[model samples]
Target: MTASDEEMPKLLGDCVHCGFCLPTCPTYVLWGEEMDSPRGRIHLMQQHAEGEPLSLPMVQHFDRCLGCMACVTACPSGVQYDRLIETTRAQVELEHPRTPAERAMREAVFKLFPYPRRLRALRGPLRAYQKSCLDKLIRRTGLLDRLSPTLAAMERLAPPLGRTPRLPERVAARGERRATVGMLTGCVQGEFFPGVNAATARVLAMEGCDVVIPKGQGCCGALSLHSGREEEARAFARRTIVAFEAVDVIVVNSAGCGSAMKEYVRLLADEPTWAGRAEALSVKTRDLAEYVAELGPRAERKPLPVTVAYHDACHLSHAQGIRSQPRALLAGIPELTVREIADPDICCGSAGTYNIFQPEAAAELGDRKAANVRATDAELLVAANPGCSMQIAGALGRQGVDIAVAHTAEVLDASLRGLGRGSLVQRPQ
Candidate 1:
C-alpha cells in the first residue's frame, strides 16, 4: 500500500509537545537534544516537508533513534510515532544520497543480514575460528577492537551458532488436529538459532496444531523494512505472502519479523495488485507468544523451579502490544517464579541493527539493561527477540555477569516436553 506522502506532515502535526515522550525516547535520554526526541524529530520532519532540504545534521538525529517504539507506548496524545518514524526513514532512504563508504556499509549489511544462506556460509568459518581459539586470541590481544567500531560491534553481537536443525515441511498435530498454521523460519532465527524454531514446532504440534514450514521461504522483510529499504522490504513481503497463503495463520517466533508482517497491509497499500493479498496476510500473522497464549496452553506446563526475569522486546511489547501474553505464558509454567526487571519499558539497545550502526550508544543502553537484569537476580533471562538476546547477553558477559538468556518459546517448549531446567537455557552469549 502506498502511504500518503503529503500525510507525513499531517502525522507530524499530531504530536503534542508535552514532554511525555522525552523520558521514553532512547536517543533523547542519551544526548538530551531536543531534535533527538520524538517531538523534536517530528519538527524536523515538518521542516523538511515544508521546503528545507534534508541535511546530514538533521538525518543524524533520525539515524541515532533506536526505533524501539517506547515513545509510541508513552505518548499521552496517542501520536503514531511508529508510523511517523517509518515514513520519515523511508523518505531518508529515498531523498538522501549517502556517501560511498556509508552506502557500501549499508549495502554490506542488507546483503548479508536478510539472506539465511549467506549467514549459513559464514557460520562454518566462524565456528572453526571459535573452536581454534582465534576468537579468544583476537579479543585478548584487542585485535578485534582494532577493527572499525561497527565491525567490532557486529563481531560481539554474533551469537554462538549451534548446529542448524533440519526443519520439516510439515509437522502434524499430535492426537487431534486443531489448526494448520505456517511457521516463519526467519533469516537469523533459521540460520543462527534453529533450536528455537525446532522447539516452536514441537510445542505447536504438541498443542494440537499442524505446523508447516515452507521451504524456500526467505526473509519476511523485517530487517529491510526497519532500515528504510522500502522496495527491498516489499519484494520480500510479497514472497512471504505467496508462500503462506494456504495456512490458517502465520506464526512468527521473532518479535521484529511478526511486527513487520503485521504492517504489510500498510507497507503494500500502494501496490493495488498486492494490497489485498498483503492485508489478508497481515490478519493471519501472529507472534509465537500471541498464538500460543490464546490457544490456552494445550500441553501441560511442568514445574520449572527456577527464577526467570522476562525482558520485553520493544517491537513485541510496545510496537505489537503483546506485553502480557509472553509474561502470561511464562507465568503458566508450574513452579516458575517470574520476576520483572527495573525499567522494563526501556530498550536493551537491540532495536533491529541499531547496535550494529550506533554501537557506542547501543553499548551504553545494553550495559544499562544488563545492570537492571542483574538486579533482578533471576536464574535465567528470557527475551522475545533474537537481537535482544544477543545484545543483552553480550552486554552482561562484558560485565562478567554470567546468566542464561532463553527465548520465551524455548522455555515453553522445554516445559511442555517436561525437560529439566538445563534443557531450557539457550543463552545468546
Candidate 2:
C-alpha cells in the first residue's frame, strides 16, 4: 500500500478519546487545547482519514508537539501515539513541504549525522567553534536575533562542543566473565560526551562483561527518521545491524538510540530480506542500565553519601516503558538517596532535535525543568539517556547551577567499583 493509505487508518483508530492523557501531555498543558492534546491529534487524524482536508491551523498544532510520547504511557485506551505521530510527521513532510531554509537545515542534519565519516570530519570545526567562545559569544551578544526564529532556536540548543573520545578497540573483563557485549557509541554522544561511553565500558567490565566498541557502527538513524528522512535512516539502520552482528548483546547508553534500535523491526519492515534479522538484533539490544541491572549479582554495591535526583529521559520512561529499572538500580547502591524530580516524567525540552528545531517552546520547557531540578536541592543528577543528560546539564549550566549531571550507568559503575563518590559528577574544565 502507499504511504498515505497506510497511515490514515492507523493514526485514526488508535485513540479511544480517553481524557486520562490530558494532564500528562506537555503541549496540551501549554496550549490548553484539546486539538493540541493526544486525543485531539487522533481526532484530527480521523478527520483526515475520512477525506477531510487538513487546515493550516491543524498542521500548526501538530508541528508544535514535542512527540515525547508521554501520552502513550498515560493513555488507558492503549493509543499508539508513537506510530500515529511518526506517520503524521511523514505525511507532513510529503504533503506540506518546508521552506527552502528549513529544508536545507533538515538536509544538513541527515547528511552529517547518519554518515560517520561526515560527522567525524565536521568535529574539528564544531570543536573550534566551542573552544574559541564563538558559540557562547553569539548567544551572549544576541547575534542570532538577526536570523529566523528557527535558526535562532537551532543555535541555542548547540552545546559547547568537546573533543570526541576515541573508543578502544576492545576492553576485556577484569576477571572471568560469561559473555561479551558490544556498545553502540552514538553520534552526538560519542562526539560531545565520550566520557559517558568510557564510563559505560568501565562499568560493564566491572560487572564481568567484556565490552566491545565495534567500529563503523554509524548513527542509529533516530534523528533522521524522527525528522522525516526515512530512506536515509533505513540505510543507516541496515549498516548498524551489519556492523554489530557478532556481539552477544548490543548495549545502548542513549535512550533515544535504544528506543530506535528496539524498533528496528518496524524501521526495516519494508526490507523483507533484513526484517527478521533486524528483529533478532533488536531483541538482543538492551539499555545500558537495564543490562547492568540484569547482571544483578555481579553489580557490587557501596555506600554513596550524596543525594541524587533522577530525571527520566523521555525515551526510557515513555517510549521504552523502562521507568522502574534505572530507579531500582540506583536504589541498589548503599547510602545513596534517590530522590524523584517533580514531574520526573516531563520532557526536558530535549526531544532529540526538538530543542534546536523549536527553541522558544523548548527553552520554556527547559527553564521549568531547570527549576524543578534546583528545587530538589540535590548535588547530583542521574539520567540514563545521553540527550537528556546533555540537555539537562546544559540547562543547569546556563542557570549557573553547580549540580553535576551523569548517566545512570556512570553512577552505578562508580558505586560498584567503590570509587570516589564524586566520580560520576561532570566537572567543568
Per-residue C-alpha lDDT of model 2 across residues 1-429, encoded as one tens digit per residue = 014476657546767776898888887777689898888887887777677766777777777788898988888777778877787777777787567887797777667655667767877887787788788788787768676665666555555666566778688887889679999988877876677888889888878888998887888888867766677678878899998899879999998899988888888877889999889888999998788767774756888777899898998888888888888888878888888899876789888888767777777788778889999998798887766776777678779888888777778778877876767554552
Best by lDDT: 1
- Give per-model TM-scores: 0.97, 0.93
Candidate 2: stretches off by over 4 Å:
1-7, 161-163
Leading candidate by TM-score? 1
Clash count of each predicted structure? 5, 0
**Candidate 1 collision pairs:** 1-268, 1-269, 1-270, 2-269, 2-270
What TM-score does candidate 2 reach?
Answer: 0.93
lDDT over C-alpha atoms for residue 385 of model 2: 71
lDDT of each: 0.88, 0.79
Tell me the lDDT of candidate 2: 0.79
